[model samples]
Target: MSKDFYSILGVEKTASDDEIKKAYRKLAHKHHPDKEGGDEAKFKEINGAYQTLSDKQKRQQYDQFGQTFEGANAGGAGGFNFDFGQSNAGGSGSGFEDLFSDLFSQTGFGGSASSQEKVGSDVAVDVEITFEEMALGTEKKVELYKRVLCDKCEGTGAKDKNTKTCETCGGAGKVHKTMRSMFGAIQQVVPCEKCHGKGQIPKEKCSKCGGDGVVRDYQKVNIKIPAGIEDGQTIRATGHGEIPIGGGHAGNLFITIHIKPDQNFKRSGDDIVSKVKISFSQAALGDKIDVGTIEGVIKMKIVAGTQSGDIFKIRNKGINREDRFGRGSHLVEIQVRTPENLSRDQKRLVKKLQEAGL
Candidate 1:
């Protein structure tokens, strides 16, 4: 229902085509329904807005009419159109597919379509790593229990496969489906159930996988977690997920990383921060102490008359850069701990010093 295409794409009305394209690409990637925490509703809205604004003629008409006309002035063969319950069963019906085709092409998103086979659905998993492990890239093996293509059948779903064009969808991999609505029957293009969007079916079903072309199995996939990867970021492992329902490019496995917090160190940019406590005597008179760094424990000096909240830097003692060419400095903050309980003799000595103004 949002009429402002510019506001939907987060751009000014006078924004250029490249600016609009940049905004659209960024927003589409962030809000893509395939990503975690993606919003499908918002994705649809942005798609509609971008579709209108991306066209020069449509953009001009939309600007003049302010979406109230919805470009009804241009009812030409090439202009965008939306009509329900009017499409015949034999002729082509349009709705979701038309919009998705245009948006997917513009956004450069693959795996949405198929030629001879269908791509599989993506799989997502969560992984946890220690701070050290995150700092240094590591490899891990993950065991996944999901549908895999039948090895015996070679994903053709038949011992000796012979393909026949699907009569139901007429080899289109999609069919016009009509559903009743309050206004009337709404028709939309949906994947054909019989052929499963492959546009063809095997002559005979495989005994092991039956006609599905996939079986429930366990697969071990080794993932190379790179250094400097942020938490909540997803890593896509190509062809490491479930096999396509019919057969095409295998789906990607998306791994979301969670980093465990370290007790002694905290991350700040590329630097590591840690706090150390020193006695009042060490702060006032200065002392040498062993401080822990990412490399190891090193002796550090506490300057004389150092006050609380003093910071000391250890060069190149923090996390390594992604390229491992250099490292960030470790910052150590000092806290002075005063004596909580004093003996009678100690109190008397302190009182004498106070009286002498020492």
Candidate 2:
């Protein structure tokens, strides 16, 4: 029986072109053979389903034939054979060549011509920085494990040798198989495992990288953190990730920033807070007091009859804005201190004045 292409990709029959492509990309990545616990058969099934659904003509025929399109083409075999040799025989004039190029490009393969330009996987790393550094921009050097391109073979996975056409798929790079299902018999094509979808095999494997085209080594990268960057923020560096297999493009690197807490200052959104202690006499009588701020100490005038726990705000003295805005204010809380011990003469004068009431 024919398999339901929509059901195979977990999409509805009326799914749009974008929806079909999205579903196929997700499923293909999940079930890719190189991934852990990936099922090659499931990946191939979805790939075939997507190939049919993504094409307007193929989708129309499949819909008319109840997802099989068994009579779309003539000859003993009703299905179309995606033969690369036949498709490329016309020298770029063939319709199948264009279609294959589009498919390969969307699937992360550089192009159909080489199919060996695979990019490496991305890497994520965590880093901690001081709050001051976050406030003022700083650069840091980090060390991590990355797969570097093979220096011995220059990422070719071959050492002083060449490669030959893959025998399993006959350089077509895919193997097609028919399966019996409830709907009928469905044909699916999958990557050739022996050549890893490259359609070619290396004659001699590299001694340093062992045919993988990458070597595990320690890598140091310098990352510049912008000013006013918030905690838990992430930054990406392009082409700084692991080296791809067989000399492809390198993946990106993701750096997550973690800001450390400060001892004297507390952060609240874009603002900062601090405590300032003043004598009781200074609070009773207006006086000039030195207030600590992130920039430096600034003189502030205290009003007469000022009470304890009173807060004073200094304009534009706090953390800078991170989202293209102005700077924030600094909030200072006042703590009034009283005399711990009084002289005997001072106590006598206070008592005499209270008794006489003069």
Candidate 3:
């Protein structure tokens, strides 16, 4: 049975060029073989559908013919001569260097043609740190399992040093196939599954990497955390991820920070809030009291006749700004405690004073 390209990509037949590309990218990322629970067959199917719909002429042909386009290839193999290098190889001054230069510029690969190579998959790890560490930076060493290129095969996945041209695609790395449609014929070129688009086959397979060119091993990485980092923040380390198949590039490592709460102090934006209890006499008569702050214990003065529930601000006693902009003020909420019981002598003295009205 023929597959519906539009339905495969979850898009309409009349979708715009940008819309089609966007849908293809989304599906490709979701169904990529590197991802967990990914289906290789579904990924290839979406790739094939996108390969046809992304081109202007092919899409027009498919719109008119439906599924018969598979028969359009000259040899009925359902392939097309796309000449992906045509744009660069054309003109009198163009050459392989120019072709590679253009490709590298678009793909962010540096001078090396191998820079176009894909990197390995990325891995994510969650870490918990104390609030003090979040306030002040900290370092962590984490152990992770990741794929690394096989040293024996040098990432070629071959035990023997020799390599031969692929027999399936004749070193072209692609197979030509034609599809017959009611409207006409559509030709397509697909990557050879046996050679995996490499257009070459190794003489022997590497036992260490199982012909996959990657081995799973434990790796230790050190992460330096900056001060004032917030909870749930993520930090990325480039090239510290899983190695790609056949030794392309390495993926990134993402570390999510989880900050633990402090028991004594509460954070409010950039400031720190805390409470202090004082005796009723202390509230009535001015006195110096020691309070805990981020820096340390600081002495704060209580004004005479201070009421309960009154707040006192200590300058630069709060949490430091993450950006080092300045320190915040610490607010201390005062609570007054009254005497639960009074002695008989104290009561008698209070009664005598009341009677004298002195």
Candidate 4:
């Protein structure tokens, strides 16, 4: 049996669209996975329920057929493709056929049409930075060979900034297309080949771009990498990706940061951890030793009677904290070294001290 979406949202079947939207927003905010005490499964269920109930057509179909529509729940609520299969319950196919045509047309299925253009494609790039750069933050310039707006046309694709209604689509931006499917002939409304859904064309094509608003060219982009950013973290720069062929909003550029490993230091959360070797005399008698940190070398005191694996902290010597004020501490682990290759006289002195229980 299908789950009752109305019950899931705590609303009546006749609830208004505004009521459903309000309920969805409240529940979504409360159950958002990023929030404290949020339930991921419950949030997805809420989203799925809201997805069907919020759409007037889908809601109507759900009310009539429950979850019987093929591909309705595929990929959860994020999936948009829906297939209203042939009705098995005996009845006139007129209602279902009308709905099929309406559904396909409004939802970009078959023989149906839309006026909206697809957005541009996103681009991703990897950037390698040194450990010091990761701790201090830096900017880098990258050259990308991607689609860029034509310099001569200024993204208009017209020679004199003049355009005319598309002759192929007759300014409708979409044309009818028919194909055979399981449910007999399905006509699809698709974007016109000539105007590319813009319903307009340049009177004179750009010599550089050849009527397309964008051209393949090299573009230099400046990226600012933030301090304390972790490896493999991506930063999105909007409008820096490839523009669509027919000219829509440019996509985003995702930069994944790769930090080079440091030989001496390792980052743990906000703190930096490192190991330093101390001699037996230094561990037993106490001494000040030089320790390497992100902020250069610092003098750290080793307490008397310190044992191996003892840790000392140098405050404010690690990477800068990105969330709040002040910096992280540097933790230095101590390793006491034992003496080797003792002379006979040295061994006799050690034996005398051992006999005296020193």
lDDT of model 3 at position 221: 95
lDDT of 3 by residue, 1-358 (tens): 7679999999988898777767877786777665687766786677567767866677788888878874462233333233334442334332223222332232322234323345568889999988667655789998998898788887777786456788997876555445443212433344455565567767888888877778998889999887667789999989899877656668889999998888766667666778888987788787999998877898999998888899998877665555778876788889888656779987786577569982
Tell me each candidate's TM-score. Answer: 0.60, 0.61, 0.57, 0.64
lDDT of 2 by residue, 210-290 (tens): 887789999999998886777899999998888766556788899999989887787777778888889877887879999
Candidate 2 backbone clash number: 5
lDDT against the true structure, each candidate: 0.72, 0.71, 0.70, 0.74
- Once all C-alphas are superposed, what RMSD does model 2 give against the true structure? 8.6
Clashing pairs in 4: 110-187, 110-188, 111-187, 111-188, 111-189, 112-189
lDDT of 1 by residue, 1-358 (tens): 5458899999999998778767876787778666789876676566567667766666888888887855464334232332422232233322234433433432212334333245677788888988776766677788888789888788778756766788997887776666543223334455677887778777888888887889889988899898666778889999887786766667789999888888998888777889999997899799999999877899999999988998999888777766767877889999999767999998897788779995
* Higher-lDDT candidate of 1 and 2: 1
- In the order shown, the candidates' Cα RMSDs to the true structure are 11.1, 8.6, 10.4, 11.1
Cα TM-score of candidate 3: 0.57
* Model 1 alpha-carbon drift over 4 Å, by segment: 1-116, 160-192, 323-325, 343-358
Rank list by TM-score:
4, 2, 1, 3
Q: After superposition, how far is residue 15 of candidate 2 from its true place, in Å?
A: 22
Superior by TM-score: candidate 2 or candidate 3 = 2
Q: Which structure among the candidates has the greatest TM-score?
A: 4
What digit string (tens of lDDT, one per residue) describes model 4 on residues 1-358? 6468888888999998778767776786787665689776786667568767766677888889877742465454432232323331133332223333433444222232222464577889999998878876789997888888888888768887678999997886756566554323444455676886778899999888988989999999999998789999999999898887767667789999999999988888778899999988799899999998887888889999999999999888777756669887889999999767889998897788689996
Lowest summed lDDT across 10 adjacent residues in model 4 is found at 88-97
